[model samples]
Target: MTESQRPRILIVENEPQASEILTRWLEAEGHECVLVSDVDEACQQLEQDGFSALLADIVIAEKSGIELVAKAKEHDPDVAIILVAPSEDHHKVIKLLKMGAYGSVMKPLDQDEVTITVAHAVERRRLLLDSRQTQQHVKEEIQARIARMGEREEHTILRLVWAAECRDEATGDHIRRIGLYSATLAEALGWDQQQVDDIRLAATMHDIGKIGIADGILLRAERLTSEEFAVLRRHTEMGARILAGSEVPMLQMARDIALCHHERWDGSGYSQGLAAEEIPESGRIVAIVDVYDALSHPRVYRPAHPEEEVTAIMADGRDKHFDPRIFDCFLEVKSKFQHIRKEVVPEGVPS
Candidate 1:
C-alpha cells in the first residue's frame, strides 16, 4: 500500500523495546502507528481516536490482551484485532481468534510477516465496515416499509372494530377500554413490548364475531332463549374462522383470543372445551379483560354494575372461569383497569 493508503494501527505492548521495534517496522511499511504499553492506555486511545487495526500483546499488566480486543471492538466494531503471543501459546491464539481477534503473530516477531498480516487485517476491517453499513441501510429501509404497513393494518383493524360495535350495543368507548385494559394486564404479566401492543389491538376484536351474527340475536334486549344462546355461543368459533389464516401475528393472536377467550379453566366453557393451561395465554388474558370490561360497561340487556360488585363477581370465578395466576395478577393491577376505563369512558357515559 502507498503512504496515503496505509492504515492507522494501534500497537499495545508492555515491553518498551518490543513496542519500539514493532512501531518502527509498521512505519517502515508506510502505516501510521500508535504505541501504548498497557491495556488502560490502549483503551483510552481506542476511545479517543480511531484506528484501522489493533495489535495487542497476549499479556498486559493485570489484564489479558483478550480484554483489549473486546474493548476495541466495542469502541469500533470494524476494528480488526491481532494478538502478539509466543509460538507455544497455540491454545491462547485459537481462543483469541474465537473471541473475534483477526489473527495472531508468534515471537520472535518476523517484521515482514507481521506487516503482511496487519495489511490483510486492515483490508478485512474495511470490508466488514462496508458490509455493516450496507446491512444497516437495508434494515432501515425494511423497518420504514413495515412502519407504513403497520399504520394501514391499524386503520383496517379499527374499521373492523367499528363495524362490530355497530352490530352490538357496546359503545366505541367499550372497545377502547378493552384494548387499554388488556394491554395493561399483559404488561403486568411480563409480556414483551410487541406482545403487549399486539394484545392491545387484538383484544378489541374479541367480539368481532358478533358481526357474523343476525341482528335479531345480537341486538336482543332480553335474555336469550336456550336455542338462541346456543346459536350465540357459536360466535366464538365464527370469530376464530373470520380471523383465521391471517399472516399477521397480531391478527393470529386476535384469532386465538376470539376462539378461546370464552373457554374456562376447568374445561367447561366453549366451542372446543379446552381446559386449564390448554388455552392459549393470550386467550386467557383477553378472557379476564373482556369480562371485566363487559361487566363495568352497560349492555343492551343490563346496566353497568358497580365496581365493587364487578370485583366480587370476578373473584368468584378465579379458579373456574379465569386462570388462577392471571386472576391474581389482575387483582394486583385492578386499579390500573379502573383508571383506564375512567380515562377512556367519559363521566355521565354508560360505559
Candidate 2:
C-alpha cells in the first residue's frame, strides 16, 4: 500500500516486550500501529475507528482473545485479525480463524512470518473489499442483461451464472471460456451437436455452489487451513444439490459436472472417489477446461502461468487427473482453445 494507505493496526498484547516487538516489526513495514496492553484499551481504540487489523494475544489481560476478535468483527467485519499464540494453542487459533480471524502467527514468532502474515492479512482485507465492489458492478450489469434477454429458462441460467460469477473465481471471461472450450472439446470428440450445446452451457455453472462459500474463505490470499479447505470443497456437493433433480437435460448435465468435476481420474478426488470411466463423461470434459481456465488466469495465491506451463501441468495430469482419450482430443483441438483464450476479454476489466 502507499504511505497514504498504510494500514492502521491495533496491537493487543499485555506483555511490554512482545508489544514493542510487534510495533517495531509492523511499523518498519510502514504500517500505523495502535498499541494496547489489555482488551479494554483495544475495545476503546476499536470504538475510535480506523483500525485495519487486530493483532492480539490469545489471552489479553484476563479476557479471551476470541472476544476481541468478535468485537472487532462486529465493528468491521472486514477488519483482518491476526492472533498471536503459542504452538500449543493451535486448537484455539483454529477456532478463532473459523470465527473470522484472518490467520494466526505462532508465538516465539519468527520475524519474517509475523511481518508476512500481517502483510497478507492486510492485502486480503483490501482485495476482498475491492472484489465485493467489482462483483456488485458485475451483478448490476448481469441483471440488466437478464432483464433484456426475456424467457424463463434463459433467465434462470443467467441468474445461476450470475451467482457463480458474483462470488468466486468465475470471472466473466472465465465463464465464457468454460462454455466455448468445453464445447470445442466436445465437438472434437465427435459428440452430436446437441451434446456439444448442452456441455457449453452446463460447464459454466459447474462452480455455482461457490455462492454458498464465505467471502473470507473464497477470497483468502494464502493457502487454506485444512478446516477451511474442507469448507471450500463442499462447493462441489452444494453445486450438485443446487442443480439437482432438474428434469431439463442441461440442468442434469450441470449437476453431474458440478459434483464430479473435482473427482480425479485416478480416484484421488473428493465428495466421491469415482475413478477412470467411473467419473461421468460430463465431469471429465468440464474438469479439463475448468483447470485450464483456472491455471491460465491469475488467482489470489499465484500469478497466471504461461500457456506452455499450463499445458505441461495438463499433460502431466493425463490418465491421472484427466481422461487420456479426451486429453488427446484436447491436444488435437488445441488451436481452437487458444483462440478462445485470446478472444475472451481480459479478466477483472469491465466487459
Candidate 3:
C-alpha cells in the first residue's frame, strides 16, 4: 500500500463529541483514523492493528488518557502520541510527555491546529519506527552470527573431548551420554530450554582440560599422590581460562561449568573455593550430572556403579556435593533419568 494510505491516526477519547471533532480534523488532512473510547479498547486495537500516530483524550470511561498513551507506546514505541487535554489538564499533559508522549493539544481543539499537530506527530513516528526496525534487524543479525560461531566452537570443544576419549580407547558415546544426561538434569531442575541445551553442550566439553595433563597422569590406571592430584585439579582452572573472554552466554556458562563442576556444595572443593550459590547454576548442575555419568560408566580407574548405588550416593551427597533442590528434582524424576540413558546409550554401554 502507498505510504499516504497507511492508517496514520488512532483517537482514544471517551467523550464522543471531543473524539469526533479531533477525528474530523485529522480526516480533513487526509489521514486515516481508528477511534476507540477507552484504554482497554485502544490497547486491544493498537496490538491487533498497527497505527502511525495516536490522538487521545485525558479522560475515558474509567481509563486515563495518559495510560492509553503509555500502553499504545508499549505496543508500538514509534507511534506518535498526541494527548488531548483541557486547559486545566496542562499539568497532566506535561506528565504524559515525560512518560514518552510526543505532544499535547488543548481540548477546545482548533481544526487547523489539530491538523498541524498530527502531521508533525506522524512524521516523528515514522522516523522512530524506522529506527526501531533497523535496531531489531541488527540485533537478529548479531544473534545469528553468534549462533554460527557457537556451533563451530562447540565442534572444536567436542573434538577435544573425543581426543581424550580416544586416548582411553573409549567410544564417542562417553561425551554424548554425559551431554544428554546434563541436559536432563538441568530440565528437571526447572531450567529453560536455552539453559538446558547450554548445559548439554557445555558438559560434553568439561574434560577438555584433561588434555593438558600428561598421558601418564591421565591414563595412570592407579591412584595419584596428593601432589599429582593437585596438578590434575588445575585442569578446571585452565579450562576456565581457555573458555573465558567471550560475551556469549553459552560459552560463558561453559567456562563456569569447567571451573566449578568439581566444587563441593559445602565449600570444600575447587581452585577458587566458590561454594553453593557462588557457583553458577549451570556449573552446579553439570557437577552432579558429570559425577553420575562417571560412576555409572566403566571408567579407567573404576568399575561401573549400579543405578541404585548411583542414586544413593547422589542422595547422600545432597547439599554437599550438589544443589539440594536439584537433587530433589533428580530424585523425583529418577525413573526418567534411566529412560534417557536407555534412549541415548546402546545395550553395551553401562547405564
- Best of the candidates, lDDT: 1
Better of 2 and 3 by TM-score: 3
- Ranked candidates, highest lDDT first: 1, 2, 3
- The best candidate by TM-score is 1
Cα lDDT listed for each candidate: 0.84, 0.84, 0.77
lDDT of 2 by residue, 127-240 (tens): 877888889989999998876763455446655586566766566667767888999999999989988978878887888888889999988878899999999999999999
RMSD of 1: 6.5
Candidate 3, TM-score vs. the true structure?
0.55
Looking at model 1, residue 297 earns an lDDT score of 78
What TM-score do all the candidates reach, one by one? 0.64, 0.54, 0.55
lDDT of 1 by residue, 213-313 (tens): 88788788788899999889988999899899989999899999999999999899897999999999999998898899888877665799999999999
Runs off by more than 4 Å, candidate 1:
1-44, 53-77, 80-127, 190-198, 245-253, 265-281, 299-303, 342-351
lDDT of 3 by residue, 119-180 (tens): 88877766676777889999999999999997787667666678655665445676777777
lDDT of 3 at 276: 87
> What local lDDT score does residue 192 receive in model 1, on the 0 to 100 scale?
99
